[model samples]
Target: DFTLEELKSLRVKQRYSFRDQQYNGKFSIITFEEFISIALDAPRVVGIYPEIKNPVFINQRVKWSNGKKFEDIFVETLKKYGYEGSYLSKKWLKQPAFIQSFAPTSLTYISNQTDLPKIFLIDDTTIPTQDTNQSFWEITSDHYLDYIKEYVVGIGPWKDNLVTASNNYLQTPTDLVARAHAHNFQVHPYTFRNENQFLHFNFSEDPYNEYDYWIKKIGVDGLFTDFTGSLHRYQEWTSPFLSSEKDAYNLLDKIVAMIFKVQAHLVLFFT
Candidate 1:
């Protein structure tokens, strides 16, 4: 197990074959605090979505003082950043954050520490839960959703799991989103990208189209896209921002039109 300093010394590289490798090793692994700081410093309000990644293995390898587990460290870092509040509360909306993890036990343990919304990530259907040794089918079952919903506000499933695809083409869509909504839980699927290889054939190689399909058609609560700018642009275009300036201009136009009509009425009455 590498200490935090040792881990920082290592450079990060692209893991996916489809991803650009030119910038490999150009970036270093960042501490959780650094990640939080980056979000806090953004020009606009930016929410942080951090994962308690691989808690089982990390706890097994990393040694901590006072016998604290990885989840403890993760949550402590969040609290240090002033990320406390229940989901959508006034405090939460100002500094939004969501704690995500694939490990159920870790989520449950940390739930007591912080009330920040948590998302239970669902892997591919073939995979099983790392901590509970439960299959995807078992976890996605309605009975399980009922129980897990108590801990998590939502589930982040693989995009493919929501819609069956074969030969890079989308097939029938699943009822997972409907089921999730029925349980009063949000569904935020992950890893959307602009790359052609990553795009399904049905989307015709356009990331915007993919976003439209998910946001408009599938009706997901949120997305985990690699191209945040692309998603932001799409959302802005589809639901254009009504700025205060625009609202003022619209009001001014209505006032001018009303004055013109009233003036015309006075002229007609005199004639």
Candidate 2:
């Protein structure tokens, strides 16, 4: 394996053939500190959602002179960058962040170190938990949700797991979102994309339809989308604020038309 310095020398490339490839070698890999800086420097209040991926594997291969676990290092970096506070707290709204991980043990350990909201990531049904070795069914059970609710503010599950599909057609959605809501936990499903392959047939190959089903029908708290622009457009098209703004503009146009008609009548009368 290459060191961080060696890794930075490599350029980024698109994984899928359908996606844009023009900028494949345009950018190099960025360090975690650089990632944090990008978020901090954004004009708007953009929240950072960093994942503690493969903690079991990372902890085994990586070592520190200070004798800290992978989770400790991760939390220290966040704290160092002033990413502390519960969900929607004043400090959080100023520089919001969510610490996510697939390993339950890592999340639990980090809870003692920082108050930043955490999300428990769920994998495919067939995959077992990397740390606890718990089956998907076991971890998603109401009993497990009850236990995990104390540590994490939400769960980020694989979208297909929440609503299964066969032959690319969507089936009935599971009650995971409802159950999560019942436990006062937010549910944010993952990796929404605009590409046809990533979309289910029920959406008629339209990303907006998929967004409608998930946002309106499924009632998820939020979505983790690959194409942020498409998601932003979808939200704007469906936003109540946009509707109200349109109504205000329409009212102003009608008033201006009435004024012009009245002035024309006055001119004719005076002439």
Candidate 3:
């Protein structure tokens, strides 16, 4: 079995056709510490959403000292980066983060290690869970959400499953979002891209329209977009940041209107 250091020596590449491949082989596989450092060093309060991808396979292949499993090392790395707190807590809001995984068992295993929010990723309806071997139907059921909600704050489902598509045209959305909301669980859909090839016909090949549809119509709590800047801009333009500058502008406008009214009243009184 290859060690972690050996794995880091290998170059990272794009495995999917839809993703950008221009930088393939330019970057080596980064360690968890390196990845965490990138997020922590960002100028803004950027949140890290690292996935414990393919836990079963990772555990079978990778070995650690003290017989630590993959989940153990994963949580340990986050703890080292001070990523421990329940959702929306002061510590979490300061350095927001979410641990995601397709394998339910991996999430369950790490539940006690960190109180950080976890997102259970749901695959296609035909696929089964990587670790538990549970069918998509079984895992997405109301009963399952009830059980899993204890461990996870939200779900990250394949976007198409939430709104089924045929021939690249979106069909009626399923009740997954509503059902998840009913369970007090946030639904964050995945893999929103800006490319025309990825956009549906209903959106007229507009990424903004897709964002509007998902954020406004679908009422999703969060989105997993490939272009974070696109999502950020969309949110900023649609929902302006409620900063002190904005509040000051609003107060200034109110004061100007009040002064105008007083001036008009004085003009009438003088006349």
Candidate 4:
């Protein structure tokens, strides 16, 4: 069991409060370094989706002797395991991953530290940003999207933002996707599940139909699921990228060169 200090310092947590209350009181959260090893060790590629869940809270409670921030440690851990280069790079695809966060400032903070793609998570309309203290409307605005698009590759909105609900009945869809795609930002909504309680009448108790509606009609770039195998199976069945390893590697090399140049230019400007 972790001490109060230790518990307050963790960036990761058990996602569910109901099924895993035992683990909650029992196990310590894994480090980003350990998480990376888990992904890399998978026989097939498995991407990680790490969230800067509570940046303001973490920084307030966790004090390091080095004066390094939690975001710094997170990116450092990733790089220590050779997690550099942009999204879909050879190094990435082999152990593909995305770093996600609700705090836009945290994403910007780590942008200079790592080139790996980041996703901005948008919570419900009522929730204000952790760092900025702005409403959901402020960040979802065109001007904000334009600014953030430079840092993150995509935005993972709450799935309900794309669709509405009334008395447990699913309502008509929203324009969240159209707006995101207009800014050329990828969209990956979250928490697709097979359970009947979460399923809508429109989906007919079939999770595949729900996937179909989201992937085919709504057009999301990726999806997050409790069951990775289902999403993997769906993608394999419907559409698969016939990517050549050599070409992907060469492109990655070029991007790394460009990234180096960008950093060098920044140093020169600062000096």
Candidate 5:
């Protein structure tokens, strides 16, 4: 409803009524550039994962001067900040990012512009894709995964869809994760919260237990949680890496070796 300048005047507040309101109205709303700046200023290498929310709706309502859709401006903004490279490339690792969107067309459109990895987001089983009008089941099919894998490096589905629940208790987990992995696509499920309301009874209402089940049991590549601190602690405790300079160098050595192996293969193929 408001322009960027007008939106900045508004203060952010907790969305859920159950949460504390102490910081409400204390901080002003910020632009996407400000969000990216925070990541760039971090002490360690921090990656940004920005979502293209409701592209179809936004394009319908907003008009750009050059007749560009919302996605063009979004990619241009990232380019303006010098963010361009394929996933895990030296340039990308320095300022890593994954552009995620539920719209397959938008992702394919941007694939022509940027090589930054994209993740396809899947909604509930009852919901159809915003752009493709494909059902959740159809999209998760082996055939569909094969097609989409060309554009997206991963899929971020609603966690419940990965592991169904009945009466607030988990049911037999689905093989979607296995199928996605078979296609060499990363499986990153979303919306893991610490609150009991979001937990299944199988987790004993413990967030760590939930994390263990998804990460260790289900073997997911990544997670989207409302509590980043909790997730960080769980990951640090479960998968601690040696912080010594020698260990760091050893890790980099292996990475360089892998890169050389890949380059050697490329040379062989071209020769």
Candidate 6:
């Protein structure tokens, strides 16, 4: 399966319209399992954000034996390949990840089998949920949020849901963020990209500004980005984890600057 020919065509292109069209001819479609393997093979702890995308369509198209649902196979595959653990456990950090879906039933179904943390994704108000066909208004109700809070560690809602847009300008931020935070639920807005068209004018077309708004103003735990490497770099620059080498380097730099200042003062005094 590890053929040079296949790897050569392994570039990734935009999966949507209004994105950079330059790389459309270069990239190949990748699977969730392959993505997991890539993360697992990384030198340090690499996190993965895998959504159970379009389960209704995938289940309708794909088949299995012994009456196994796609959910069954999917959870089994992850567990089989060593992805079993609760949220933020030692085992989970070894393969840091979150399983997300719009269908609440799917989350409940997998709950019986695995303790891995799950996130229920919310779309716009008019769209019906995938499994139960509940409208977004109903699913997003306070009662429902309180109910699902037990099953899910977080909610991944559309970014617009966080802040409404009125005539292409941002309105007052919604209480949804505050309510969700009250219940100790993490809010991770979806599908942030790095294009002028994707960003609103409020952020000055800088992705970091958008990140600052979401992380500081709105207060989300994580973000779902199209460019994982860019998010990694942004997080490292702004809110870097205190690794030993980083700490040592920072300390050394501070000491060296202090020594230079001290030497300058001594030379002035002696002269």
Query: Pick by TM-score: which candidate is best?
Result: 2
Q: Write the per-residue lDDT of candidate 2 for residues 24-63, one digit (tens) a residue.
A: 9989999888999999898888899999999899889989
Residue-level lDDT of model 5, residues 6-97, one tens digit each, is 88888999998787889999999878999999988889988999999999999999999989999999999999887989988998988899
lDDT assessment of candidate 4: 0.83
lDDT of each: 0.91, 0.93, 0.92, 0.83, 0.92, 0.83
Model 3: how far is 35 from its true place, Å? 1.0
Highest lDDT against the true fold, candidate: 2
lDDT by residue for model 4 over 1-271, one digit each (tens)?
4586786465545675544455554545665566678878878867677887798999999887789998988887787777777887887786667899999999999998888999999989899998999898898988899999999999999888788778766788887788889998889898888777788788889888889999999889888888788877777666645245546788999999999999999999999
TM-scores of all models?
Answer: 0.87, 0.90, 0.86, 0.78, 0.87, 0.82
What is the alpha-carbon lDDT for the whole of candidate 3? Answer: 0.92
- Model 1 C-alpha lDDT per residue in residues 1-271, reported as the tens digit of each score: 5678898889988888777899888888987788888999999999989888999998998889999998988888888879989999998999999989999999899889999999999999999999999999999999999999889999999999999899999998999999999999989999898999799999888999999999889999999988989988887677645455567889999999999999999999999
User: In order, what is each prediction's RMSD in angstroms?
Assistant: 5.6, 3.8, 5.8, 15.0, 11.7, 5.5
Candidate closer to the true structure by lDDT (higher is better), 2 or 3 = 2
Residue pairs clashing in model 6 are: 11-27
Question: What is candidate 3's CA lDDT for residue 222?
Answer: 97
Better of 1 and 4 by TM-score: 1
Per-residue alpha-carbon lDDT of candidate 3 for residues 60-135, written as tens digits (9 for 90 to 100): 9878899999999888888888897899999999889999999999999999889999999999999999889999
Worst ten in a row by lDDT for model 4 = 18-27
Supply the TM-score for candidate 2: 0.90
Off by over 4 Å in 3: 3-8, 14-22, 242-271
TM-score of 6: 0.82
**What lDDT tens digits, residue by residue, belong to model 6 across residues 39-122?**
888898777767777888878877789988889988887887788788989998777778999989888788888888899999
